[model samples]
Target: MARLLRRFAETRPDEIALADEEGVTTWRELDERVDRLAGALLASGLSAGDAIAVHSANRREYFEVMAAAGHIGLRYVLVNWHWAAQELGYVLRDAGVRVLFTDPAFAAQAGEAVEGLDLPTRIAFGDGIPGFLPYEEFLATGPAGEPEPQVMGSPMFYTSGTTGRPKGVSRKRSIVGMPVDVLALAADGFATTFSLPGDARTLLAGPVYHSAQWMFSFMAFMSGSSVVMRRAFDPAETLRLIDEHAITNVHLVPTQFVRLLRLDPAARQDFSGESLAAIWHGAAPCSPQVKRQMIDWLGPVVNEYYGSTEAGVNTIIAAEQWLAKPGSVGRPQPATEIRILDSDGVPVGQGQQGEIWFRYANGDDVEYWGDPDKTASIHRTGGLFTTGDIGYFDEDGYLFLCDRAIDMIISGGVNIYPAEIEHVLITHPAVRDVAVFGIPDDEFGEQVKAAVELVEGIEAAGELPGELMAYCRKSLAGYKVPRSIDFLPELPRTPTGKLYKRLLRAPYWQEASREI
Candidate 1:
């Protein structure tokens, strides 16, 4: 048996390991299924270090496959189900996926992605996907006992592809020599940092494919925490799940926080999220206003982490700490060393904004799966690697992010961060979401532009833009405030809360000769 599941199955066999919308899966059942699936993968001529792709929504079977792959030495690629056929196909090929597992919900796109590709194995979780093996039947084919030679495996997550085609974020410290026992032990320690003890029950309302969600849920699963998950995030449903399941912790993005805060006053006041001990959020710059509301409503359980798919969680701040240091992402993790460097790679002084770089204590670093040039672009001397985030540390050591280097707008020789404007604009009553970026400005080189998504039933006409601009003027300087505002019914944002700013900014910059 795998080290993780075996220990849990022996001690807490009847405890629920995973609960999706479909049903709950006990630890014993999960252990047995994982063993069989691991056996089947090994029996199908998949050796250690082989790759498989799982393209599905949040489900019990998703973790089952992940656990099975982790027990053996198979790298599991968590595909972004939102990708178009061409984009999906590119990832499948780039990862050299031998077997593809998908949900019936995305059957057509998955099928089109694999069409004429060399991938020979296809397994579907639910009905209605033709030419693919059923998940249950495939599991039944494997041996009932534990697979031999258990080794640790890790996930290879792809970048969100906001800039261009996504690249796989692979760790330089390969998993080939790591044992499952060591892996389980590490997961237990990692979960402890988030206050997730062995008996904690985690609620996963975000997509598991996201690195943060994946780390929170799966690591807790390995540490004996039961997970309650929803297919898609619903504000009311999230509160209900926490109350119903006695959920101890949950992973959320800033966007979800905004939505939850926007819920009816009755709905917000009716349910008490007393069981929630930790509400960790990241993946985007959360508005100070939204986060304050969540903390005020949910007590001080709302914690924040600063990280990316390429760089693991480097900094974290508790709600209390965040209250003291508003707009800060908090201090660096114990094992992380943070450095802010200028454009010439020189380390910047404290309180001076520059590109943020990280150095892991254990010498761990990120690499693109097949693109060495892309990987080298983010690396610097002394084993420091950057995620292109612009941030600075205060004298007290709290990290405050300005924006992504690519998203910085320069107007009349002054640098403006869109996140600062977006954070303030989103606090307005009529605004549901907002995206701020740089547009062509012949005088200032590049001017600030705002794209706002209004609240439900609010029209995008009349004095709303002026009202929003006036609201910003009260809190922002003249250059920092957006020069113009465009109303959209909705902004292009991923489920995980990352805005597709390029999509919003492309049209205005299409005819420009130069790039920032």
Candidate 2:
């Protein structure tokens, strides 16, 4: 990354590389900041591969810190902006972060999270915070010279930990230096496969803490593409940014789609969306009905991919291909290998449901930081790792995922996947958000249940539950339909729309004296 910045700074010194609320940063300014940050980190007595944590919202300084760490081969952990202090502390201590960076928005949480830790440095940006050094002051102390022996570093992302404590998904990095354009190459390969334009101009509304959002934002900078980032997501503002910035590519989740599509028609009346070359989405299952409507509205730029943080994205489906297959997550391209195997470790036949396993074609590996026993549990005899996702490849080689293995419901010898039910229910006009899970039942052992959050002004009373059941019955099997639909003001979800199925499923089990 250091080499890449040097090259860019020389070639496109005046070009706008990044734009956020504070305003734009030119390539030259960004390059200088990264060098100074690298110097600051080294002066703090941290060495290559040492970990630092950034628990803040999206901003220019945030990327500067990350790019600096990458230049010096230091692992920068992106702490989730939405995490509570206790949750954030678990990840900080587990990753062994030596330096912590935070912004005023999270100063209180950061302080609480790092309270008793042996942290050597706490740097604050935005407004000054007590017990934290000002960011600019710290940067000014650095030598303003490039650190020697520069090598690449990478961000360590933690799982959302909806089911358990967050685990650090650390990818192994080599100390050996690679080409300056290497980051662009890797990002471009994935972008190109999904129809991201060569002259990509991206608007990132998703928080940078998530892996998918980080790739769309920072990777554009690495590739010399213009990046417009918003600190938070707002449905109407998303369209305005894309239109105003003339963005060519975007990364989004299904929930964002629901919000954008639900906007008043007057708001979307002026949205041409013609500048978009691709609108890639992942991180959760999308409703097929909602997806088709988006394709209708956005002109078929809605491509999708399937992969986990542990495994680099493995499969991609273009807009055209997705229209034909409807629910498939494209075919595996170069650099990734995906396989589906049964519980017995036997390869599942085509179109048969099984646990999904994948790895790089060149045989790279990933591990949970400081948890070998947990790491070893996810690995098979060979190098492949399973994120515990269940899926199958269609006859045409497109991958179709089922629910996570742990979330699959088996009742009376029938296997039920909640995603299918949720997909069906999500298309209902009155249902704003929904989660389907299994609740303990003495007769059936486990029975399908749906927890729904309705749109504003739509009361859960009246025939809402019955209407939803009838609506789902149109597409789902009798046993697969939720036996009951409980109304809630909201469903518990990570910021990215991934459900905390365990949280919704826990109460009934414990009360029934069944172990979960």
Candidate 3:
């Protein structure tokens, strides 16, 4: 990271390297700031392989903290800005973060989360907080020069921890004799798959706390590409930014696509994303209808991949290819292997639904920090790792993901995938958002249930419960249809597009003794 930043500073010192609502930072300026921040971290009694917690939203300073930490091998734990005090506290303590950096927006939450903890330092940006030092003021405390003997740093991403505590994904640092640098391997794969040019102008439309966003933006800087970021996602503004900035690449999720397509038709018609070369999306399963709609509007620029925070990019499907294959997540990319294993850990036949496992060609593995038992549970006897997802591969080798194993519904001994039902429901004109899960049933072990949020002014459809059920009955098997439909104002979803199905399902199972 230091080498790449230094190269850009020397050759294209004055060129724009990154920008946000706050302003822009050039290569030379970014390099200088990164050096000073690294110095400050080191001067604060941190060293190689230490951890720092960055609790903030998408902003310029978020990247700065990452860039600084990258130089000195600090593991920067990405704290979800939406996490409650308990959630925040769990991750901070688990990662053993020596210093915590937060923005003014989350000052109270950050303070409350870390209260009574043995934290060494706290730094705040954008505005002053009671118990924290000003970020800009603290940055000045270190010398404005490069730190010697640079070692690579990495970010520790916490899993959703839907059932328990969120586990920090700790990676092994590749040092002497390591055949490949993991970051370079990952960056090269991203650059090649997404067509990121050295002169690439990219738009970061999602929260930086996400692993995909963090990896892609970090790779952009390493590739000498300029990044344009927004503090929050606005559908129309996303389209306008692509045109205004001549953005060559951007990342999004299916929910964002739904919002973008929901914009006034007139606004969408005016957006000629002529400058867009790649529109990469993942992190959630996209409805086929929605994915097709995006492809039609974007002109074959839409790209989708399948992977998780624990596993890196495993498969990528381009817009043109996706139309022919329909719902596949393309073929596995180079240096990645995909395997399907049944409940007993036996290999499943092609087109057979089972747990999806990933193995790095470079022999890399992932472990949950400080939780060897949990880490051991996810890893197979081999080096392969499963994120507890169920999917299968076609004869042509394209992978198709089903619902998460944990989310699979079993009714009357018949297995049902909520994703398939949700996919059907998402296409309903009146349904703006929906989540399908299982509720405890006396007759069967579990029964299918769906909670839906209608589109604005959906009352025009006359509370279409009957129509939604009829719509599902047309495509899905009767057993897969929801036994009951609950109309909610909105579904519980994280900003990154992960549905909090656990929260949505907990209420129904409160009186039951059955395990969900």
The global Cα lDDT (0 to 1) of model 3 is: 0.84
List of clashing residue pairs for candidate 3: none
| Per-residue C-alpha lDDT of model 3 across residues 368-432, encoded as one tens digit per residue | 88889989888877798888899998998999999899999988898899999999999887888
lDDT of 2 at 472: 90
In angstroms, give how far residue 409 of model 2 lies from its true place.
1.1
lDDT per residue as tens, model 1, 1-516: 666888889998898899988899998999999989998888888977989999999999999999999989889999999999899999999999999999999998998999989888899997668888999988889998879889888898998999999899998889754787887888878787888855699998888998988999988888889989888999998888899999998999988888898899999888988888899999999999899998888999999999999998988999999999998999988889999999998989989999999999998888999999998999997889998999999999999999999999988899999999999999998999999999999999999899999899999888888899999999999889888999998899999898999999999988999866
Please give the distance, in angstroms, between residue 229's alpha carbon in candidate 3 and its true position after superposition. Answer: 1.1
Candidate 1 vs. true structure, TM-score? 0.98
| 1 versus 3: better TM-score goes to | 1
| Shift of residue 165 alpha carbon in model 1, Å | 0.8
Model 3 stretches astray by more than 4 angstroms: 172-189, 460-463
